[model samples]
Target: MTWETVPLRSVARVDAVHVAPEAISTSDVYVGLEHIGRNGAIDETYYPAAREIKSSKNRFDGRHILYGKLRPNLAKVARPRERGVCSTDIYPILPGSSVDRAYLAHFLLSPEAVGFAAARTAGVNLPRVSWSALGELPIPLPPLAEQRRIAAILDEADALRLTAICRLRLFQKLEESAFELVLSVSR
Candidate 1:
């Protein structure tokens, strides 16, 4: 399939929100850089209640894709399920025009996109891709239906990978237990 391409800004709004402390309710959810996972995963448990944070943060709804801007190589980006606040290091991007949010999230996690961010990253120790640089990155634009289809396929692949990793860990634990039992018998 011939996938048309566009600048990242053409299909999405990056760093489009900033919320004052008082404006956000204590009950609101807060997503930090740690909450985002590699390859578009999100660890919801890592988030804190909005009241726990004192400084200003970016506001985002479920529609936005939360991305970790601090280290682009980590590929920390995800689509949240509810409205919330996130760290300044995490950009909440909202898809525009014919763009699919899920597709956009997957795209951000792609090697090419991650490389683009990594290349544009600034700073010595804490390298980061400024919002302006992120917006200028190139992105593929497929039809909305196709985008959803591609996203679904990618999601299934991700699920399979997670399952495989889980099984590997379980097997390792079983092996460790068996080894311990053998040592006890030898003693």
Candidate 2:
């Protein structure tokens, strides 16, 4: 069955929820656009709001995905590995359980979807995504089973990419070691 493409505003409310600054006693989960990965992984570390929540900040279950509405091209988004909170800049997308987050996240990262965002982003000296246009953004859908498969494939590919990066780093370290050894011997 074909899933309907509803505006994000229809799927769930995308309003910003504020955290009082006085609530925090210690530094905790900090999230910002810098934490967002171009590949859609979010690393919540030292976010400004994290310093403000005493008991808890804006916590989100892994089921919900976060988006960076500030910059469209960044493709900054992620589904929390566990329940966690983030800064006010990140939008917590609380869709009904029927909506597959993995599916939604995958769709959000599509070049076509990001392209729409690029066309609509408006600003003067600093470019900011058009949040209203982003709200009404169209999302494509596939069967739930297909969505799961696609997510799995994506995860596997991501693992490989990370592995390749590690190998490249090791190779570079070896190259540096070899150069150092040559210099020492010559001395």
Candidate 3:
């Protein structure tokens, strides 16, 4: 089936709600670029209080897809689980009614979109993909049902990959213990 391609802006818009550092409550969660992982992984463990944030930040709800503008090649994107504030260097994008949020996040995390962002980024020390440039990215649109299905599959794959990684680490640790036991017995 042929999918209609449209500009990213047609499916999502950057939420521009900026909150001053002083305005943010001390208990508020703050997410910086460091808190976001490549390929839509989020480091939820790093929950810094708002008081730790020195600069102005953008407010985002769970519905927002946070995309890191700086160093776009790293593809720092995340779907936050709760309301929080993020660094100004990140854009909190909200999907349009026609688009599924998870689908949009996966699309943005795709290598194609990451390459497009990397090419469009400017600045030497702090290369970034501006909202205008990112908005112009071509998105392959499918029916809403298909979009959700694809997103679900991708999410499942991600979960499986994480499980595999954890298992590999556990095996490595077990091997190390076994080796140590063997060496001790020889002694």
Q: Estimate each model's TM-score.
A: 0.91, 0.80, 0.96
The global Cα lDDT (0 to 1) of model 2 is 0.68
Name the candidate, 1 or 2, with the larger TM-score value.
1
The alpha-carbon deviation from the true structure for residue 135 of candidate 3, after best TM-score superposition, in angstroms, is 0.5
> For model 3, what is the alpha-carbon lDDT of residue 14?
97
TM-score of 3: 0.96
Off by over 4 Å in 2: 1-6, 10-15, 24-28, 44-59
Error of 2 at 128 (Å): 2.7
lDDT of each residue in 63-156, candidate 1, tens digit only: 8899889989999999988888988898888899689888899889989999999999999999999988999988889899999999999989
Candidate 3 — which pairs collide? none
For residue 40, give model 1's deviation from the true position in Å. Answer: 2.1
Clashes per candidate (backbone, < 3 Å): 0, 5, 0
How many residue pairs in model 1 have overlapping backbones? 0
Top candidate on TM-score is 3
Evaluated at residue 84, the lDDT of candidate 1 is 85
Sort by TM-score, top down from the best: 3, 1, 2
